[model samples]
Structures are given as C-alpha cells and as structure tokens.
Target: MHAALTFLLLFLMAGTIVPVNRHFRQTPGGIPVFVVSNGVHTDVVVPLREPQTGTDWLEQLQQPQLTARFGSYGYVGFGWGSEQFYLASYGGNFPKPGTVLRALLPGPTLMHVDFYQQAPRPGKRVVALQISRAQYQQLTQLIRASFRPDSTGATVLRNAAGYTPEDFFFRGRGRYHALRTCNDWTNATLRKAGLRAALKAPLAGSVLHQVRRSRFHAAAQ
Candidate 1:
C-alpha cells in the first residue's frame, strides 16, 4: 500500500518567535528558504514568499513518491509541539461509494492520522498526520521523488491537481493567490473536512524528541 503524506495547520501563524534561520535552509539555487524537514537531509523547498518558486516546487512532488509512499496515501503535520512531526499509514484499496478511507499512526504520543474521502475538492483523498508511518512514507516519497534529470527539469511530479509544493511542504511567510500562506491550505482543507486541531499549542519548554533532543538541548545552552 502506498500512502501520500500531507499536513494540517495547527498554528494560525505558526507562532514561533524563533529566528528565521533556525526554521529555514539554503537551497542548491543559492536561495535562503524555509523548508519542512522530513527527518532527513532532503527537504521540500518552500517558497513562502515567492509564488513562481513555490509553485514550481509544489509541482515537483506530484509525479511519484507523493502517490506511492506507504500504500495509497499518507500525510505529515505537527504533533503535540513545534518539535514533533507526524504521519499516517494505510493500504491502497479504494473503498465502495460513500465508504470513506481511514488509517492510523502508531504510538500513544497524542498523534494520529485522519483520512478524508474528498480533499482539495470532492472525490479526492487527503491524509493528515501528526506522527506515524505516514510521515515516514511521505518523507521517503519526497526523497525518492526528488532529483530532476537536470536543474531545468521539473521535480518528478509537479502537475497533479492535489500536489501543492507550498502546502505539501511548509507554508510560506506571506499570502499568495487565494492562500494567505501555505499553512492556509492545511488549515482550510482539514478544517473544511472538520478535523480537530492535531497539534497542541507549541510547548514553551522546547519539546524535543530523541532524534532532535541532543541538537535542541545543545543549542539551548
């Protein structure tokens, strides 16, 4: 089963006063950019301020992994805090008419996956995750789908109506088109489908999990 990893907005403004550098990374294009890390070096470049750039990036993930990760679909989003990310896992079987798809993310860390029968529009499926195999699959698919034949070539998948680089990755800092920010896509989509907030408020004490604890702790001192 291949799963597509997606995210939902927990914070209306991503309320982190942290330095922009801490949240952003440099791209091969020599551009300083914000990104959504998949717990791997490969990141989804987010053009929070640039529509042309953002759209180009979003289009790239549409081809393969975005559709193949997990089983049929998966999603990624913030967990209980800013430090925790999540994903949901599932198989690739479309249900009978009106039979909505459902999946779960493992662990008791206040995280889970919610499957939407129609997303971005009716008859479309969208997966939202806070922590689970879906995140893993989404990240893996992003990595797998990366690598254009050349710099001029588009990222493997960039034309699917459902794949929005800005939304799939991280929301940009400003509004673009109808989306006030990439986060809006997440919030609107999940909220439209009536999803409860998947993330608790950002932890004041810096909630770092094992993989990030050492690095996060080191920076605190």
Candidate 2:
C-alpha cells in the first residue's frame, strides 16, 4: 500500500510541470536528435555517426550483432527500463501483476534499442531537438556508459529476441523502479547533453513536455 501510494504521488508530481524548457534553435545546423515516445515510454534517438566529430557510435559501443545486421541504418533509438516489464510491454501485451510488483522494487534492467532507416518525423509523440557538437559528445558518453560491458569492454547482449526483427536487447546499467524509470533515463541523457529537459521526468509526458515547442515548423524537403 505504501508503494502504491508513493507511486501515485510521484505520478501526480510528474504530470505537474514546474517550468517549460526553452527549445533549441536549429539555425546552426546542429546534429539532429529526437526524443520519441509511444505515449508511455521514451527513447533517445541518435544518428549512427557524429557528422562533425566523425565518431562512429556503433563502433565505440562495439555492438557487433547490431552492427552486423544494421550497419547501414541511419539512426538508433536507445531506451532503458525494467527487464520483465519492458519485455512484457514491448509486445503490446499487458504485464502480469507479479511483474508489476517486481518492477516497483529495484530490479534488473535492459537497454531497448531500435534502428531507424530514416529520421522520424517530428509530430505528436516525437519532439525533434538539435544539439551542438560538444553536446553530442556528451550524449554519446552518457549512453555508452549505460551499457554493461564485459571483461573485454564490450556490451553484453541479452539472450532474448526483440519485438521487432531488427531491434535487440542488451544488458543496461542501473536499476529501474517506480521512482526512477525509463522516462527518467531519457530526461537524464538530454540534461547531460546540455539540452532542455525536465528536472524529474518520471513519466514520458514529463520529458516530452520539456522539449516540445508550441509550434513545430517541419523542415523543408
């Protein structure tokens, strides 16, 4: 009961925004990044390469399996969440009560990665943001550290299939619970990159509201 009450309070707090963030200006031709949500969970979408620094994100992470299959992919979406709940929810199936209870406590987590053929259009549930070169470096560093590396310093892949054929699961650092969740991780990544984000993003709406501008002027084709 305590946990349930605490969760409810946090959810309410998360829904109430203190202040909105000043959206970034794309006039400088900064690298394009995205904060995408399914109206529930959030993900940080980054290009495979840092065009300015020539940093190959896939190579730095050494995602061999992912690289082998999606070498030509344009962008990748990274999300962190509770393993059981994420696995159950990824397929659009409702997680069991036991899984929900377990997730409320600190538990094992997973990195959910999705590759994109083209950049996602900025619309509802997708907020487009641009970060400077230095910010991109910080973003990569933050995300790279999230992957649980092995003795050889390579990220360990989970022995499980993903909801999509191309996406895959990987061991992620940190524990996930009701207080700190997938949305929190997304907000943290954005904050670390010096981008606009909520101070405490316990829900997808929390983070999305931070980066979303009142008007979205889609780029010219």
TM-score of each: 0.19, 0.86
* lDDT minimum window of 10 residues, candidate 2: 212-221
Instruction: Assess candidate 2 and give its lDDT.
Output: 0.80
Best by lDDT: 2
Tens-digit lDDT string for candidate 2 (53-124): 787767875756667878888998899999888877767688999988999899988888888988989998
Overall local distance difference test of candidate 1: 0.25
TM-score computed on alpha carbons, candidate 2: 0.86
- Segments in model 2 whose C-alpha atoms lie over 4 Å from true places: 1-16, 20-27, 214-221
